[model samples]
Target: MYVAVKGGERAIDNAHAWLAEERRGDKAVPELSVPQIREQMALAVNRVMAEGSLYDPDLAALAIKQARGDLIEAIFLIRAYRTTLPRFGGSNPIETETMTCDRRVSATFKDAPGGQVLGPTFDYTHRLLDFKLAADGDVDDAPLGTPHPDATPHIMSFLDQEDLIQSEPQGAETPADLTRTPLELPASRALRLQSLTRGDEGFILGMAYSTQRGYARNHAFVAELRIGAVAVEMDIPELGFAIEIGEITVTESETVNQFQGSKTQPPQFTRGYGLVFGMTERKAISMALVDRALRWKELGEDNVGAPAQDEEFVLYHSDNIQATGFLEHIKLPHYVDFQSELELIRKLRREAQENIMQEAAE
Candidate 1:
């Protein structure tokens, strides 16, 4: 039997007040604005929006402010707020093929179509802290080149033409929304993607690294990695047509893995796909690698019990909210359970002593 602990309402209220004061921190400093955070701390804003599954920069910025710069807490706040809004309907999937690419690169090919535009990336920067940036933090925007007007074709399509890569079939089926329903095993690619996009960045990175270290060695090559903006359109039932709603920046990564072929199938390379909100290349790439690893069963490849290959393991532990709540619950009072354990131990020790005394007397 267990007893519940109670009576902390007053303490809780006082603690919350103290927390709010600490969150503001030193009234002398100027308060941070949402727009400034949305603009200047763009990357952090992007992360919150990405994980929250919401596209509102203003709201994400506000969440960041309320969370006192804690990015994970900001994501949780955004996610909680998002649930209260009435969802009209699902939007049509944005066509990535028609993206206005700002950054595009290929690891397999030196000179890919669109001329390998490295619009903005930190790949070449020397890893040193700039004292000048710390002093004033003012830097001019880098010069831009004329973007290719045409929608850049995916690099994987070239291999697809030759039947040298696995093909993804177009379907009219509506995919499952993990947010609305409990997760079930043998998840579809759509559900898996949803889990990965909103998953903890560090966990996904670690899973991807495990594959590189030979846990499920797929020998992945970065087929293409792109960052760009795409228009979002939603259908109007009354009007009987879809119109452009808005645009959002995104990063997409495609990893080509080793060939999979048997007597029943042709020798063709398989692919892993990842698309994330905003310029999150590392997450996108990491997601792609983990995605491929998780598809071992679907691809008819043997599962050697790799952590990345376990769908239930990956999806179940991905959400930070669930993880945090369970971890924090250990701090709650467990006096009843502790007392039960203590009584059982005492009874077992007493029985042992009585048996020992009888044996000595004999």
Candidate 2:
């Protein structure tokens, strides 16, 4: 049986009008400018860009404003907008080693090649929210000391040179794009990273937390976490040389985890890598932990059936857009289904009562 509810057009239009007013809030206050959101709410914009797979701050800011500060909604808007744009050739991979880092830290080594520069961080900040920020959004910039002229070498490279850490073979094959193709189980490292990089922050954080609490424990140490601006370049066929496209701020984290070397391999440390748009260290760190946990099979470790270890589970549930659509779709009218369920329950109860009455009479 099927039932169709009619006459929702006017109601939907009225609801949308109300939603528009709600989004604008009180008219007395000036509407938030896209520039204001971009410059002030930079972190939110960054998250939108990162998840949306687009890195335009202005567009991200506009999306944020349109979404009424709902980050997931903003990301959805950006992703939807991105899908309509014409494709250009891919840019070259960023050289993070040459990045002009604003912040660099190493947990493993006390004094690394570049030295421990806590350029700008909330790591040691008091959690107390300053009410003053509500009145004034201005923040004073701190002075930066002279940075090391030499490139900040990776800590893992040093370990790798000494044969203390497992060396990964460089792959010449181009990685698969998750957006272009359907997700397959037992994804490659590149595919897994693509999923993690765009996955919901809270979901990734929770999965990473599970690993710390002894579920597929990886004993990860932050080998190095760097925040900086890297140059983006693209090759122009006409020019026959790569040209600088633009620069983007990024956070990169490398985690060294405990290893269980097998008969063919010697005892060596393994690594998990995370790279995300903007200065999002927390997300990057969390991403790294989850990435490392997912590589149990490749590392010759037993599968403990942990949430982090399940590629299918992590990859499937990590997408917020997909999750949100299914969750919100439940609100749609299911009158026919409900009616069927109601009749079934009523018939079952009636049969039970009749049986009881007959038994009592006997």
Instruction: Count clashing residue pairs per candidate.
Output: 0, 0
Q: Total backbone clashes of model 1? A: 0
Please report the candidate that would top lDDT against the real structure. Answer: 2
- Report the backbone clash tally of model 2: 0
**Cα displacement (Å) at residue 245, model 2:** 1.5
| TM-score of each candidate structure, all chains considered together | 0.93, 0.94
- What lDDT tens digits, residue by residue, belong to model 2 across residues 278-323? 8788889999999999988878788888999989999899999999
Against the reference, the lDDT scores of all candidates come to 0.88, 0.89
Which pairs clash (backbone N, Cα, C closer than 3 Å) in model 1?
none
* Tens-digit per-residue lDDT, 75-166, candidate 1: 99988998999988889999998988888889988878766778777799897887777665676676666555579999999888998898
Q: Which run of 10 residues does model 2 get worst, by summed lDDT?
A: 141-150
> Candidate 1: minimum summed lDDT over ten consecutive residues — where?
1-10
